[model samples]
Target: MSALIDRFNRRIEYVRLSVTDRCDLRCTYCMPKGFKDFSEPDEWMSFDEIERVIAAFGRLGVHRLRITGGEPLVRKDLPKLVNRLYHLPGIEDLSLSTNATRLSKNADSLYQAGISRINVSLDSLKPDRFKSLTGGKLEKVLEGLMAAKNAGFSPIKINMVVMRGVNDDEVESMVEFCIKHHFTLRFIETMPMGETGQSASSQYLNLQTVKKQLARRYELIPGMMPGGGPARYVRVAGTDLRIGFITPISQHFCETCNRVRLSVEGTLYLCLGQEDKMELRSLLRNGITDYELERTLRQAIDLKPERHEFNEEPSKVVRFMSKTGG
Candidate 1:
């Protein structure tokens, strides 16, 4: 009843769980301005329900759990959930992806509760541009990052989704920032997801351009992965901190896709770029047997796409990345 595998023989060992769709900030790339007002708080999964699902996934060979959201820290009692997941027997890695606005006050508590790693969404280094992109105060995010580090979260990962005209100029500066601060900086290629289709049209900066721009300043060195994750690391010429790239568009990793997602609404998404999902909530509420749940998981994995045709067009992406649980 605990078995889980896809047709490609990639074991489903990682699960990204969306705790809440509610976020304080209105990021231009992900959600529309003040979209939270339209969101119903009751639609989100309860902490207990999420824990039950994580336990089930853990039994089925899902050892790594990442908590994401419109912003995960937006959810109350997050450290309590982190502690629960931390003590789960089979769960080896418990991480979080957040905007870091709230972490300034909660980072210490989260670290104490045993959050293994953290990826902060910081799109721009400039305070004004940062405010424009995320409708958030940049000072808060920086403060959060500092707090996380001071609180003893090592090897912090910073995600900077690069758009051609927007913050591309800050690539080198980000590299320097990561290196100086000793954080693992990941420059992500903007995915074709967003309400406005800005992901497709707004100067889609690919990894090639990013690497070329970085090569001028730093000697890119191939890195070894201690664990199986998408970030292809390279040591900047003079610094010890490594910069990574998640080129889902340029360098597709579908063949080695070892992850699944649990949407905040309790749907299971096999792929991030696709909308076809299974309603786990229905089965859970209907008192579906564990065996039946196991069967349903296998069926979902079997139907997982070989690859996402992201390059097709903006219309091709069936769901936005925010809803897909990143």
Candidate 2:
């Protein structure tokens, strides 16, 4: 079987597939206020096209798939899509990243379909602050989280983007909450992606600092988790809950990047911090054969940059994180 190996010898075995760019919440960091520039429904790849793309990747030895979105659950008949991707040959694992606002209604179906793991974005536990940050009801997210847990999802992850003076004060409290619920916690450092992200750069708190503060309280023993993302994990001394730190700024993990992102419009993004990409939707719609699609994918992988210039060139990327898929 052929493998997607880049120039740097990084084997690309994972793909973060964005099913839709439409999200239910208007998070301040993700979607700008009054942001209306979304792709038309006709522009998105149909379910069959998406499946064919994944199968092509699967044949290239890409077994791990993560379904992302502005919020994946907002897409209609998502479980049906999940079921299709799960049965694709060579697919070893399937996961979803969501805001959990709609998980309450879709958790059972999604779990039964094939999603064995999930990553929920929850930045604040306070209702008012949650609404202020994400314009979402905290209770809805909480309910959705509980539903996901009850549906038998293992190693549920809570992704919290740590910002200075904004939600940094709740680090310990968030840890406590995760410990109580047996969910893994991950702290992320915000990057300058687009307009909103550039503005939010003021609140960019370094994860190294956050890790130091965490060490003052808990004995963080370094460990590894099953999911194939770029998070450095540590097991909390006394509990089963593991903590992960995703430091894209202070410590870029580009050297070990083994994944690429595919936008809903079928644009394959080679790097999160770089704009190098290739459009596959047109090729698919143009009646390109499966062999031709796989060749295009390999060509796309050849364009992957050695590393992103987020630190040196914070303004390099002008697209919103929502458009890039989580």
Candidate 3:
């Protein structure tokens, strides 16, 4: 089968599927301090429906899948869904982007269910600072990370959203932690994907400046990860750890964007920064034929934005990142 190609000729091989939008923690930047904006239970796509959609995507040459959410682990019986997706015919890689709040309880089960890669979002190592940043105990995440390590997940990556003043001091300390544990560290530039609901916008901290210092401190050799996203990588000289930067604000990597996102509501977000989405829930439940499903997906690909516009004081063209499974 021919690959799902977007308007710009980028092969769409990866999909970030959000199982549920309900999260256990309220991160300061990610969600409002007292936010509880979760869709109704029935509104969520069922496991069967999710599998069928994934199967359709697999038929269209989508090979990599990342289970994401407000917090994927918060969804009950997630391993069941993970097990199903892992056995999909054309799926080459299965992973999850999580906060690790519940990884300790489920990491072994997730690994047994065929998920071998994981990305944990941890902004600060200081317990007090972490509590202030994410409104959750850092100790739980630490325990979960240890569980992931014990479960034998390879190449665990820690994602740190760098803000100019908040937790930015932890950059070196976070790097030190990753180096000590032999984990990949990725510093992401906080994006204005949407307004305060999506996330509280702050002064973005470009990783290039940090990269310069790190380069001066150690040899920075360019490298790549196994799958998905456009974050560039640099090896840490003589160690197995690699430092990564997901700079949506400082550097645009959309030209090479090769993935689409599926929101919990079954909307296909062609670009992370755009609101253009195609509703697929009705089609899936209406018993749409495989041919029709493929047609709808291809049409959605045609609508994928060339790039995101995030330069203004507040980018007015995007949805809440939580709604889109960021």
Candidate 4:
């Protein structure tokens, strides 16, 4: 089988597919208030189209698939999509990234449908502060997380975007909470993606500092985990819980980037920090053959940028992280 290789020889094996751009929460760092600009329902790739796209990638040796959204749980009948992709030939891994507000109700169905891993976005443990940062109820997210755990999801990851003045003080408490629950913890450094992201970049706290703080508390032994994303891992000396650092700013991991993002509108984003893209919806809707689709995908991958320019030009990309599928 042929593989998708870029000019830099990075083999593309993973794809972050956005099923929807609609999210329930108005997180200050993600979506701004009263943000009404959303893609039309018809504009999103239908379940069949999504399946075909993934199958095309699968035939080209892409085995890892991550379903993301503004919050993936908000999409209707998402488990149906999950089930379809789970059984696709050559697709070896399937995961979801959600805010966890709706997980309480959908966790069991999702787990049964074959989602092996989950990444929940939880920035604060304090109820009021959680609401202030994400305009979401902390209890709802907490309940959803417990439900996901009980449903038998292993290595459940808690993604905490550590900010300086906002929720940096809660890092220790967050780690304690993750340890108590046996969930893996990952710290993400905020990137200036769009207007909201640029505004939130003011609170950007370097992960190196956070790592130093963590080392002071626990012996962080360098470790590795099973996944295709760009998170560096460290195992806390005395526990099974692993901590991951996604330092896009203080440190960029673009050299090893092996994945690309596909927006809900069927646009393949070659790089998050760059606007290079290829429209696939029109080709799909116009009766493009599987062979043609695969060829188009290869053409798209050939244009993947070597690295993103987030540090050099913070405001270069103007689209929100929500629109970019987390």
Candidate 5:
């Protein structure tokens, strides 16, 4: 089968699957109040259900997959799920995105289970500031980072959500750490999301400003990050470190968007900054065949928007970034 191209002619080759929407942190940008209306135990798609959907995607030439969550590792025995997805025929790349709190304990097992790459979200390098920002101990995430490196995951990425005054002060510190450790660091602009809706509007920091600050100290050579996401990667001259800017707010990447999201409750979303979505869990539970599933997905992808009007309408999304599996 050929790849599915959207109305804009962008081929959809990746999918983000949110295994769970529950997190152990109270990151103000993602979940101000910690938890959400969690999907009931029965509401979450089963491993079998997820596999079928992934297989359907594979037939459509969508071979890359990334698992996400409020915290994906927080879900019980996540390596088992990883192992399952690893064996699927069409999955060329498999990864997980998390806060890395659980990575300390599960990194080794997760690596052995076929997850070779990971994206760990770390906002601040200062312990106190990090605690205040995410409501989690910074030491735990650091420990997880070490464990991940030792586990042999290549291109372990640090996703730092840069804000105006929140963690912007530590941008240099974050870059130094990544430079020292040979890790890829991506600075993401805050988007207006979550129930409180305070992070994006109040805390949004332009990446262009951050880039200027970086250019003063180190030479940032232009490049792209491997295992492609939205980030525009740049090489830090004379170092193994690479800096990435995911400017969803300041600069939208929707025109080149090549991914879709499947929430824990089985909903399929075409755009990250939009509220519209298609119900897939129900259709799966209703026993649709693989062929029918592929047809439905093609129809949805055909309607995928060329861009997300986040700046035009900041309140476009009220759901937390956690629920959306960003």
Candidate 6:
């Protein structure tokens, strides 16, 4: 087996493919009004094209694939794509990250189609607070979560991006909610994605403070979550539901990072926080052969940075999380 190592000396084994740039929710942190003008519908890659790219990467030792988007469920015929991805050789695991607003209707179809796991984004528990932060209805997302559980999606992961004074007060409440429902609660640190939405002036509740607060309420025990992305696993004492912290800004995990991202527009970003990317769309449209596509995959892997500079020089460059396939 050929192991693909980036410049960082970290072996790349995971790939996140964005199915679309379109999303229903207008989260303040994600985009601005009138973004439709800037977003072009023709930029999206077709399902067959994405499958070809996945096959190319599979040859390069990428076995784990996660489907993400502005909201993956918003894409039509997603289960078809899931079924296609599940059949790929060496694909040990296939998962998705969704906002879960429409999951109530889509969960059963997705689960039956062969997706192994799911991560739902829920920033606040309070309906009004959630509406304020997400610019949408909270009840819809709650129903989606319920539907996912009913569909028997094991290890349901809930992602909470805690911004100080935004949803920080709900940390303990979120933990209790997760324990009550047997879902993994993951806390993520907000990063400076771009200038369009919430910027660095917004206070981010550091992970240390979050851990200290959670420690006061629950006897937190360290643990591991299978098929990792960025979250550091922990189990709430006396409960089965796990809690995870993804400290990208305050404490970077670039050293252990093992994933590569492909934008829906067909740009393969080696780093989530950096703007450096390799365009695979041109080669695909030009009818590049599979063997040549594999070569391109290796070229992209070779260019992966040793680490990101967000910790020391966050202001040097900018790219939105939505655009970066976060």
Comparison by lDDT, 5 against 6, better one: 5
Off by over 4 Å in 5: 34-36, 198-200
Error of 2 at 303 (Å): 0.3
The sequence of per-residue lDDT tens digits that candidate 3 reaches over residues 1-326 is 67899879899999999998888877766666687767987889999888988998999999999999989998889999999999999998999999999999999999999998999999999999889888899999999999999999987999998887887777888878999998899999877765653355655777898788777778889887776867899888788888889987778898999989998889899987777789999988888998898888989999998987675435665456677887
TM-score of each: 0.94, 0.99, 0.96, 0.99, 0.97, 0.96
Candidate 4, position 59, lDDT: 98
| Candidate 4 Cα RMSD (Å) | 0.7
How many clashing pairs does model 2 include? Answer: 0
Q: Clashing pairs in model 4? A: none
lDDT of each: 0.81, 0.94, 0.86, 0.93, 0.87, 0.84
Candidate 6 structure quality by residue, lDDT tens digits, 126-215: 988888777889999999999999999988999998888888989999998999999998998877667643374366678889999988
Question: Of the candidates shown, which would achieve the greatest lDDT relative to the real structure?
Answer: 2
Question: For residue 205, what is the lDDT in candidate 4?
Answer: 95
Worst 10 residues of 6 by lDDT: 195-204
- Where is model 6 more than 4 Å wrong at Cα? 196-200
Off by over 4 Å in 4: none
TM-score of predicted model 6? 0.96
Per-residue lDDT over 1-326 for candidate 2, one digit per residue giving the tens place of the 0 to 100 score: 58999999999999999999989898887889878899987999899999999999999999999999988887889999999999999899999999999999999999999999999999999999999998889999999999999999988999999999899999999999999999999999998999999999999999999999999999999999997899999999989989999999998999999999999999999999999999999999999999999999999999999999999999999999989977
User: RMSD in Å for candidate 6, one decimal?
Assistant: 1.4
Q: Rank the candidates by lDDT, best first.
A: 2, 4, 5, 3, 6, 1
**lDDT at 195 for candidate 6?**
66
